[model samples]
Structures are given as structure tokens and as C-alpha cells.
Target: MNIASRPTAATPPPNALITEAVQLIEEAGPLDDAAAMREAMARRTDLPGRIALRAQLLGQRLGLQHELARARQWAPWIGLGLVLAIVLAGLGLAGSVVGGAERRINIMAALVSLLGLHLLTLLAWLLGLLLPLRAPRLSFGWLWMTLTARVAGGRQGQAPVLMRAATRLLARARLLPWALGLVSHGIWTLSFLVVLAALLFALAFHRYTLNWETTILDPQFFLQAVQWLGRLPAVFGFATPDAGVVLAPGGMADAAGQRSWALWLTGCIVVYGLLPRMLLLLLSVAMWQWRRRGLQPALDAPCHRRLAARFEALAPRAIVDADPGAEHPPAPARPLDTGDALLAVGFELPPDVAWPPAGLPADARALRIDGSAEARRTLLDTAAQLRPRALLLACRAAASPDRGTERLLRELLAHCGDCGLWLLAEDGGAALPETGVQRWRDWLRDCGLERIAVHARLGDALAGG
Candidate 1:
């Protein structure tokens, strides 16, 4: 008889076979390959149910593969868009300068052009620094680039792939506060010089207007000129009555002939010159406030709350509920002896918490390899190195236990013992060893590891000095 036409059982069907397959894998039980298969098949005696289950699993796999491919395609484009934006902004700034100088492109105009160029560069750098998080398009762009790299390897044409990879670097904005601050300080310092130049220009122009008799170089004249200039309207548009420091107007003049020219010049100078400086100072002050308030009890409470929310979304867990505010007992730290080679296993940790302590031993390195096939290969390669005191393993725990994590642990354990391996975990769960801890230890012993240390606390000697 054909399996598809097999008679149904007298008992009513309780659950779909696909659901049963997933449930069987999830519920903890003894490991017997043949028995497990028999149990799974027994859940759905009908051939059609078993066939439907297989089809469902196949479809899920296909969907995941398609997502990976789409992510790959998007990654490089994101990176390119960022880099292009930088180049375009630079060019646009140059265009604005050329466009500003309608006819009499004198020394003063040249200086103004230089100042505009400098501001444009600063703007580009800030945009680049904040790109990762601030630029909405970058995340998918990075995802695509990474996927492309995984598929194409070194064989993928270098330009498009590499460019996207470069753009994706914009997303890591945490480092921006310091790096951008240093650059900003430099830019603002240069800006101070620019403002001083503008002030001096205003003073000289005033001196020339009020007293053509007195020498332009006279210090007394310069002082008086500046004093009068400062008294003028803080807001742009009202021109000095006697001063000949006219900024030529462009476009159709609406407020009569000469009046429109004065207003336009004042508007341009205020916007392009004074406004940028004011904005820079404000941003610098705000950055200072954020850093200062970071330590305050009021600020710390809110920041901690925000941080907890972020952690919950990234890696959901029940165990991550420990008070960030409350001081806990420090974990014991043990330094590893230096060897010829060290294997770093793990993913990069978020910046708020410290890892790798002060100084990791030269012979010992660790990588945060979570649930990834590439991560597994990375672990196995280090094991193959076969040097004494070779392998170091570490994991940042999720806030909660889930099926995906449990599968990762199983895979990690299956290939762990080759050289000395150190497994570190933030908290015990699927990311840590669940079963066969002794078996793994035995394998390590056989591979010449003197001793294997296990600890639950994150702030331990194994992490660093």
C-alpha cells in the first residue's frame, strides 16, 4: 500500500507533526539516535503528516537562506552611499564658494572660501562618525556586505564589495564621542582663528570708512573701528550706514535696489560664518553635559534603565536582572602562563562592561564565539594549532535561555578538545556548557591541558589582569 494513502488512526489528531518534531527536539531527553527517530515517527503514524512535516522544515530553511542573500546584497550599497555622501558634500561646498564669488574675487573672498571649505570638511567627518546609528540605511547595507563577503570570499570583485564594507563601518557610533571630540576641538580651534580674521576685516573696513585721513595700520584706529563694529545689530540684515564693507547680493532684489544688497550680504555672513561657530560651541557644551551627568545618581539611574532596555532587546534573558547600580563581590582573577601561541575565541563585547582586564597574557587570547558556524570553525582551527596552552574561549551570556542558544552549545561541545581550552561565560545557560562538561574536560586532559577551570562570574582572573 502507498504510504500517502495509509489509513488514519482511530484516535483524533492532537497536534501537527511539524509541531511535534519541534517539541521533541526542545523537551530534554536521553540521547539515542535510533530511539529518537522512532519516537519522532511514532508521533505521526500517517505518511501524509510525516511528508507535510518535512516540507514545512524545508520551506523554513529556504526562507532563512533567502534572508541571508538579501542582507548580502544590501550591505555593500550602504557602505558606498556613505562614502559617496562624504565626497559629494565636499564637492558641494566647493561649488558654494565658487558660486558665492560673483565678480570681484579678492583676498577677502579667498579667505571666506577657505573658511567655508573647512566647515564642510568638519560636517563630513561628523556625518561619517555618526553614520552607523544615525544613518538609517547603513544597518541593512552592512548586513548585505557581510553576507557577500561570506559567499564570495576573496574572489568577489574588490571595488564594489570593499566599498560597501567600508561604508558599513559608519554604524559603530559609540567610539564617536572621543574621536569626534578630538577632531571637533581641532576644527573649533581653527574656527577661532577664522572668527578673529573676520573681526579684523570688519575693523579695517570701518577704519577705512570713518577716517580715510588716519593710516589704516594705526592701532588706535583699529581699536575704534572694532568698537563701533561690535555696536552694530547682532542679527543679520541691517548694514552699517557709512562702512563700505558691502557683500554683493545675488538673485532678484525685492526691498528696493541698494537696500536689498545690504540685507542679502548680512544674511549670508551671519548664516555661513557666525551661525556655524555658535552651533559648534553648543554641541561641544552638550557633549560635555552628557559625559558629566553620566556619573550623577539622577543621570546614572536613567542611563542604567536605558541600558537595561537595550540589553533586553539585544539578548533577552532572565539572569541579566542583576542591579547595575548595586556593587557585587568581585570575581577571582587567574593569569594564564605565556605560551608560543594563543587563540582568542568570542564575539566583541559591548563597551559599557570591561573585558580582557588590563593585560591579557601574550600566550592567551580569546574570541566571543556565540551561535555561529563560522565561530565553530574559528574554534576548531585554534584547536588544530596544537601548541601548548593554545585555546581560550569566552561568551557573553544572553538575558534568557532559548532554543537557538542551546543548539550552539551542543555544537561547541562536540568539537572543543584539541589543545588547552578555556571556556568563559557571563552566566550559566546554553552559551555555557550544559552537558558533557566532564567529557570535555577529559578530552582536554588527553590533549595535554594540565587543568580546566570553570567559573560563572565574569569579572575573574581568566578574563585578564
Candidate 2:
């Protein structure tokens, strides 16, 4: 990535990001002071390079290189799984429309059957992106991460850090949506292609009588619908069935009428289904590529700060006499180490979600944040005083993770040694069209909550670290 020569927003490559995350983990481990000093002094490259090289050296020494390699392969594997799933789904939807080749085909039913789930999923993705939730799970990205951790057996080693680091880097770059969007649109494109192919084959071989049968509605509704839906198809050479065929109650239409209906159906799927998805796939690809190049690290993060300090301590100095009159640079500050206490806070949670968590030690303290500045200040002050071993902040699942929420989390996190985010999912709360658990995880990852213990259940969130 050549971070030194690049612009300020320079992004490390995926491998470098993984290495840097490993560096953070190593720095947080048992501090062997003399060993660290010797390692730091031996490096003479740019800070980013030195940091990356340090992780590589540590990984080999710790026998974690295999874990890193496995972690790097996860994204591509899960992505392939996503593509295969989508293709089968498209084929299944199309097959449902064509199976049991009877004489009659309901145009309305066919259209809805073919595109219902696809359109619904598309809408959900749009909402997730628009709300700026940065939904890493809106597609299969979260599943990819989870599968990676489990499959790679990352519960103990560098694999866990690798997954978290990847998510954080992608989220921090604001690339999660675009990256997932590209996968989504690409898969959808392939699915619709399958649909188009299936439809073409059915139309070529199987002849079905096309008719619209309504119970109580006026016939005019059916006539107008045909014209409205077929307008785009007509612009391309596909013909809409005439009023006689459109209003026909049974399969009374001639062969020509049947052919027009088939063409109209095929055209609608192409114009409405295939072309739009294809265009969106192109759009997603462009956006992802454009944003992919600048995945900057959170250099100001406490973990990085501590490591940078250690590295600087052994930094080479030019042979010059110390200036007695010059002011000395202050030593870097160390983050507060955790004590034995745990603090559980519910941030803007509704009345139902239990506060103080059910089970805690006698020394543990709990509070609910009411979104007031005073309430937040009290919480931070309390954290500073308590120096809790672990802090679990429970928040509403359905609520949009707005900027204010992120800011509050960032501030509270600094006061505690380790943090867990409990996304409180109430029984009746409004949710993303998909699951809310993953959506919140996506937001947390973007917040740079490394190796975050994201829990749906309050118990798990408050469990011993």
C-alpha cells in the first residue's frame, strides 16, 4: 500500500490490515518490555510498514501464519456460496411459473411469482443503504464473516481478529454497502439471467393460453393493466395482447394472441427484471472500486496509540546534542487498564429490556442512558471512576444508528477496557425486512468496535469476559 508516499487517506491492503490488527493484539498481550524494545529498534522502515512487518514477524513466531492465510480466503468462498444460492433461487422462481404446463397462464400471477422475493429484497437493500446503517449483513457479508470465524476455528487465535479487522476496514472505508451491493446486484443479475433463459425456453417449447380472470373488478382494469405493463415491452418490439385477449375469461384467444402474451411476459421480465438489475450491478461495481482504495486505519485509536508509543520509544535519533532550552515532547498516554468490576448500561432502550442485567457481581454497577448530556457525562464519569473490566452498552435494535449514537459509543468506550454492544431486540419492535441482529453488527463494525462481542440476548452481552 506504500502508505508513506500515498495521500493522507491511504488505505492498507487487506493483508496489511490483517497484519496491523494482529499487531494491535500482540501489543495488548503480556508486555515483555525488553523484547518489545529490541524488536522496535530493529525496524527502520515507515511507520505503517514497520507495523505490518512487526505483525508478520510475530505471526511466524507465534505460529499464526496459517490462521491468517485461512482468514484471507473466507470472503471469496462465501461470495461464491452467495452466487450459487441466488442462481438456484432464480431458477426455482422461474420453474414455479412454468411447471405443470397447463393450457392457461395467469399473467399477473406469473409476474408476481417470478419477481416478488427479488423485488422485496432489493427494496430492503435500498433502505439499509439509505438509512446509512452500512449493512454488512444486508447481503451475505455478515454470514461470510461468521462462517469464516467458525470454519477457520478462530475462537482462540488470530482468526477472530482477522474477521473483525476485515469488517472494520471495509466498514470504515464506507465500502461495506457498496461491496455487498455489488455482490447483491451481481447475483441478482445472474439470477435474472437464469430467469430470462428459463422463460425463453418455456416460451419456445410450451404453448399456454394466456387469459385474465377477475371475480368482481371491472374488465376495464384488466385492459388498462395490459397496456400499462406492456408499454416498455412495446417500445422494444414485443407486442401487448389486444383487448379481446386481455379481457378473455378463458383460453378463447387465437394462437397469435397466445404468442403476443408470451412475448409480452418475456419482455416485461427483461425490461423490468433483467435490465434494471444489470445496470445496478454496474453501478455497484463502480462505487465499490472507487471506494475500495482508501481503507484508512484508525490511527488515533487507543490500541494504535499505545503501540505507536512503544515503537517511538526505540526510534532512532540523529547524533545531535540535546537542546537544553527546547521543550521536550510529552510521553504518550497509556489507556486505562480494566479492574475487576463490570458495568452494564442500557442506552435509549425501552422500558421492557431489563436494566443492570440480571446477573452481576456485587461490585458491578449499572445505569440507563436517557440521551441527555448530563446522563452521558455521569456514565463516563462513573466509568472513569470504576474502571470496569468490561462494559456492555445495550441499545435498541430497531432504531437507526445515527451519528449521535456512534459518538456516544465512541466516548463511553474510551473509559472501559473492553466493550460489548447489546442490540436489544424486543419482540414487537420494528425490524429491518431482514434480521436486525446483523444490521446492528454491521453498524458496530463500522464504529471500529474491534473483536466486539455483539449479542442479541442481554445475558450473553453481560456474561463474564
Q: What TM-score do all the candidates reach, one by one?
A: 0.26, 0.60
Residue-level lDDT tens digits of model 2 in 1-465: 111233343435754565656655655674344553466458634465555556656656665677767766766787788779888887887777776557467778888888776787777777877886656364554565677677775567667766666667777777766766776777778888888898789878987766667689888987898899999989989999888878666747788988888998898888888888788788878887788776766554445534544554345332123334543333223246768788878787655445765555567677887777898889889988887778887775534555566566666666676788776444323222224466556655554554456776655666634
Superposed by TM-score, candidate 1 places the C-alpha of residue 446 at a distance from the truth, in angstroms, of 30
| TM-score of model 1 (CA atoms) | 0.26
TM-score for model 2?
Answer: 0.60
Residue ranges of candidate 2 with Cα displaced over 4 Å: 1-12, 23-37, 58-65, 72-77, 101-103, 134-138, 141-145, 154-160, 213-220, 319-465
Find the 10 residues in a row with the least total lDDT in model 1. Answer: 293-302
Error of 1 at 146 (Å): 27
lDDT of 2: 0.67
Best model number under lDDT = 2
Predicted structure with the largest TM-score when compared to the true one:
2
- Candidate 2 contains a number of clashing pairs equal to 0
